[model samples]
Target: MGIAGRQNGVTGGMILHRTVVLVGMMGCGKSAVGRSLAARLGVQLLDSDAEIERAANATISEIFARDGEPFFRDREAEVIARLLSGPPCILSTGGGAFLAERNRQAIHDKGVAVWLDASVDLLWERVKHKDTRPLLRTDNPRKTLEEIFATRVPVYQLADLRAETLPEYSIEETTDRVIEVLLTRPDVLEKT
Candidate 1:
């Protein structure tokens, strides 16, 4: 059952006033933490990347290969907008989703962005074994990852709330930290 089953089951009935958007660089555990958080809150967990892939009937890498990044980014923005218009839920977006000003504005207007902060080394440790990450398919993936990390850190800082992930924390612990951050902003999430 884990933390989700252990948490007060009342979370399912609690009112979510706005979407909780998880924004961060790749390997920051946004997807893992988002899933745990949604289970703990008993709300829908939406992943913009997964939604885009489902809508396009292709993997993100395929979408990028055939349509290019500009097209994929456009589709990403559309997916984020469509999802945000729905009921409040937990949204785990792609690492680059927050890089666009338009997406940032949409998230700010309809949701609360939570930046999951992890050290670059920690991020590398988690992602080094993953081959599915489209953006890391480079001759020097580590340097590429570092470059992306440096560029995205500033933008991620613009999120409404922040949660830190340590090497020792489990996914549920990270989700709990995110919940603590959300609790500080009743406009986004409230205890019922």
Candidate 2:
């Protein structure tokens, strides 16, 4: 169906009470947009990575350094599952979380998954020199980011809805666009 038709159908009240999950690369503004969207929708905003860090009682980099990526991902999935069991809320997942089939299934079953799309240049511009991202600590951060983007874009595309975010767009605009899209997907609005 066309975007307009889908929007009309969803807003017609067939479904409600489902959560919204934002999945994208690290620099794609999921956290920023999710926070705004959640505030506007009157729901809590949960960042999966942050939760994982809390659960681990350490920073993400510390977790990565101490346990490695596989271990971190396992913790991330567990945290995500726990978060999904709560009331409807806006969730912002780490860039690599949705790349795992189990994690993807968990999110798909619990909420509306929206992929925040942005170009590599835009992503680099946003993330460059950001020391917080554990994965970006390499000799060639740009090359690392590029490789990550190439590998994960397809996985991100599996989201139920795709919202393109421009480099110039403000967080409010991105959040609004996401809300507009979410208000359009009946399947997304459906309660589990």
Candidate 3:
């Protein structure tokens, strides 16, 4: 029993009828919430970033330093497209994944993108202690993060649906919110 059991007018385990692609800035809990969402749905969570790392045998920061952002982004697009063509599951993408029209088009074609909305303050708080963020290695990370947020929010707004991530909520609570939002689109999620 999961979302299907909890949602009104529904019965049985959750049936994820289409791929749910989680898109948002780094540290917004896409991976964390995807884990919970997948568990509730009885499916696997595929993280595009992890998939890329596995394929390349290198961490994202390593790839960024070796092949640069452009090459890494190209690989990201390929991985996203390939994953979306697979079975229905939860897919968590990188912070910048949805910025590309090609990736956006691929997601629109085979899956639905769910933007995990978190405020700049929340994102900064979550990421400040993590040195793994290559994009934030600038002279001033907070300022850089704010700049990136400003540039990407408009593109993220194009997601098919959005679920908020608040500082007051636990990962499970956030996952539930995502489930509630997904429940609104029967084509993407349902009870079977």
Looking at model 1, which ten-residue stretch has the lowest summed lDDT? 1-10
Indicate the residue-level lDDT of 158 in model 3.
Answer: 98
* lDDT, model 1, position 67: 98
Candidate 1 lDDT, tens digit per residue, 79-102? 999999987888988888899999
Model 2 C-alpha lDDT per residue in residues 7-71, reported as the tens digit of each score: 33233333336777898898899888987876666567888888887778998888989999889
Q: Residue 146: error of model 2 in Å?
A: 1.3
Better of 1 and 3 by lDDT: 3
Point to the candidate with the largest TM-score. Answer: 1
Name the top lDDT candidate.
3
Over 4 Å off in model 3, which ranges? 1-12
- Candidate 2 — number of clashing residue pairs? 0
* Candidate order, lDDT descending: 3, 1, 2
Alpha-carbon RMSD to native, per candidate: 3.6, 6.3, 3.8
Off by over 4 Å in 1: 1-14
Worst 10 residues of 3 by lDDT: 4-13
Residue by residue across 19-69, what tens digits does model 3's lDDT show?
Answer: 999999988998899888887777778889899999999999889999999
